[model samples]
Target: MLDGIPPLLTALASGADASIPDLAREVPEEEWPRLLEIVRRHGLTPLLGEAVLPHGDTCPPTVQDALRTHRDYAMLWHRIQMNDLALILEALGGASIPHLLMKGTALGFMVYRHPWLRLVGDTDLLVPADRVEEAHELALGLGFKVTEEWADAHHLPALQRESNPPIELHHQSLYVPTPEPGYTLVPVDFSLLDAEAGTVDAGGFEARVPSARDALLQLSCNFGSHMEESIARPLRWVRDYAELLGRGRVRWSEVEERIDFIAPDLRTTVLMSLALARPFIGDSYEPALLEAIDGLPNPYARLTRVVSPRDMVHEWTTSPRRAWHVLSCLMGPWRATKWSLNKLLVSREHITRQTGLSGDALCMRVYPIAFALHAIYHLRRADRSRGE
Candidate 1:
């Protein structure tokens, strides 16, 4: 309820440490409307409710009614998702294909109280890379409408069903952990999917969820990517981390080692997650993780954990030194060179996808024009910034 804090920030890091009475006392009754709206926007109804429900009878029924309403709505979606998941799993079982559930859906049944309170929007299931085509076929057989685009670099394009959340069948994870002689990015081994992860007891059937350690990575990766957007991702994601951490299963040291292997550029999302969760600047986070965050080549990159990339860009417009630091941290000479090479060579397929043009001749012709326009747009934006 602090006025000075950015409107985009629903809950500050310190709020995690504050009790419901403290929150209620700090946010006066006149401000409850705004506070409630913030909590609602951040998907924190159940989380906040759980913290303060002991005083339910003392408080107004409207607040209780709101919590119950949100929980009821979430529960309905949870049942629907479970049913849909069962149907998909049954089909996959018949086809002898095993899969791992990812993100909110996985965390719903496994990490949280139930899938209902967690509020999943869609089902994200990771199938083995070899089985992606087969899974795509199975989805088609099950009458799912495929939302295909050209050359999906990561996961297979989403497939949809009527009146149900869309299913995204993934072959590649959001952060591709490719460890090799010439390593670009590396994290955990896929073997951990089966070996470390356990099956969730979903009444009659079971669903697979990542080990607690791995869940941290997934949660962090998802959080890092979405932190800049003033969307519900960070709100729900923060609670997810809280829930997972509360379970008391994750080993921070092991998690740190794996994060170190991936490098901060790849693990930046998780690092940002830790900053929000533990507030590395504060006391909640461990020293090792903080060390890992500090180990990133550029120290200024840490500012991104608190403020968004867009907000930082605004700051860059006013300050040359900060701008230079950000540019240098994100783009070294070697990375810049590799990026140019990729744009000239590997970007052709990506360009084709962007343009929705299939033929090589047409795509190649359109790409240079697209690149030129993109460059011009950036240059104009820079010039405007200089003027500002």
Candidate 2:
């Protein structure tokens, strides 16, 4: 079992109301002071302060400082995220691209009563594949230009500007590569333009958000589709779920039915949230959902432990290795091989476009040399593991 270091530390010093004893049991006595000191320095003291002690227990000064720092960092990051979200929404709205806001920001607007707690690092927008080019042009027209373009057309291009925040324009909901014969993971077969377009008054300009149900599905896909070794993103999902459940706006039965139809294996997503957030929300999750989640394989189970937001985001956003891993797991052996070959071909085309190098010239070029290094690094580990 991975020691629940990050979560436990957060709970103790961050005013995170949860059962810490069970989590504390996972930490060795010798490591407690170190963990406590880290949490205090990180500004989690308000949450992890006196309330955490059993009876008449005292905290060290170092722990206090860490907690304060954590709170400060969190507050600063939330402001940054909020500002970015506002900027992106303004740009998109100006472009007239009817977009569906997804994941963290969507959850913040719909579920998390306080948007600050949702903690979005960047903005994610879903536009239909057909409108993708139009959306890109519109963003550029509004001063947001493509910062980094991925080689695959299936992937969204990363957009940013000098003064504005970054926006990821997703053409599809789930990016399952081509040549992998399976159902396409597109967005809900409903018109986002006609959906109830609510606005969020974020002090300056109002930010448009998606419907509650769609936001829920996006969050479900965000958690379910990616590797879940990090705790931060899953924890954010748990917070969103708890708030959504508490509000009682969405019918539990309806959510479950959609999960069955849209994302059948979303049980993994629910389980990871339940496991990490159980301390805060308790085991009040629906019985059927709990049972289904328990049946997922070990790899899925390992995702619940992922705690760093950066790592979790990279797994979904840019990591080629993670994309390949997810494809291999979902599509079996034979189909995955074909998918891998197709990816190499696509990568070659991507390289060619980015740099004016092709064929034999490309093979003998520096760009190909770098690509080879990346491929070798990715494959070499697998080769060594097999030999082991």
Candidate 3:
């Protein structure tokens, strides 16, 4: 099943432009049946063929099978979102955290026709930075253990819950690395919280969400930071921005002012989002959106292309290199080196705590091989540069 279906599903997931014939040619003939079953289960077959398959006179049998089995997976993804949101709000209320729902769920409840139509995996909640520790305690009290214990042990405040439907607690608006030295597009300023809580009924569950302006800023900063697949969680932010614009919830000028003041570097991401969702958002924002695009730096301006191929792969994979990259991005070069060394030391300490190994013994057993590999890679690169 994996041999046949994994590659095909991967292609579809990555928005690849392979045709039915093209896919059939690549897939192993013996595994085609199992591959088709997996594709049907995911409900991606029809969307893949109709939206992605190239025009051709000859179509593969798998194409027809996939089309027949295709259901809207987006809707299913949405139902999961609704269930998760319900759980998140319940957890927050139980914990006594005065939370504001941030991105996808908030947008869906406020603007979209059906909340399930917008695909979201987890629910995001915002609390004051000062209240972050309180929020974590609240989540723990409600049975949601932080998923990344290593991160928590390292002093990163973000925590994930162990609930069937997980909730992520954010005290800081943007993710900052301990080793990385850089300012975010959105500075960690809890002063921006001017809370105006209102309730929305989702299938009889009441949800309390953030104010319109703050919600927009949170979503904008999140999208800006992770520009690669901002579009993956679709329609929520578009609906929010459009509805806010339509209702005069906040003036266009005020939105622009907040964008400049809070997440100035996100101008590129916001404009790109407006452009992608223009079909849903409409033409009125085109001029201002283009102007925002023009204001972005050249690197950011080309963000769409910059986050291609390997970028998407890295995001989905759990390779150590990706972990290292995340560490590097959070902490700049010098700090990353120091952090890695400290992490190695701490890891040894933890190992010693669990086992009876002394610190020097653990370091001798572990550090030499790792350090040797680093030395070999650097020396080889230097030799290549000198025509070795």
How badly does each model clash, as a count of residue pairs?
0, 29, 5
For candidate 3, the TM-score is 0.51
Clash pairs, candidate 3, are 144-162, 179-331, 180-330, 180-331, 180-332
C-alpha TM-score for every candidate = 0.69, 0.60, 0.51
Q: Which ranges in model 2 have alpha carbons more than 4 Å from their true place?
A: 1-59, 128-130, 151-155, 163-165, 174-183, 190-197, 228-234, 245-251, 259-282, 291-388
19-39 per-residue lDDT for model 3 (tens digits): 445665666656766665544
- As a TM-score, model 2 comes out at 0.60
Which candidate tops lDDT?
1
lDDT of 1 by residue, 1-388 (tens): 3334432233322335344544544554465556566555555565556555556552356766666766666666666667777888888888888888888778877766556656565678877777878988888888888753523454677776775666788765546211111123333335545577788876468888887767777777665433322332345665676666544556568776655654445565566456545431234345676686566444335544434433332332233333223333445433322332232323546766766765545434564454344344434433322101
Error of 2 at 206 (Å): 2.2
What CA RMSD would candidate 3 show?
11.3
Q: What is the lDDT of candidate 2?
A: 0.51
lDDT order, best first, reads: 1, 2, 3
- Sliding window of 10 residues with minimal summed lDDT for model 2: 379-388
**lDDT (CA) for every model shown?**
0.56, 0.51, 0.48
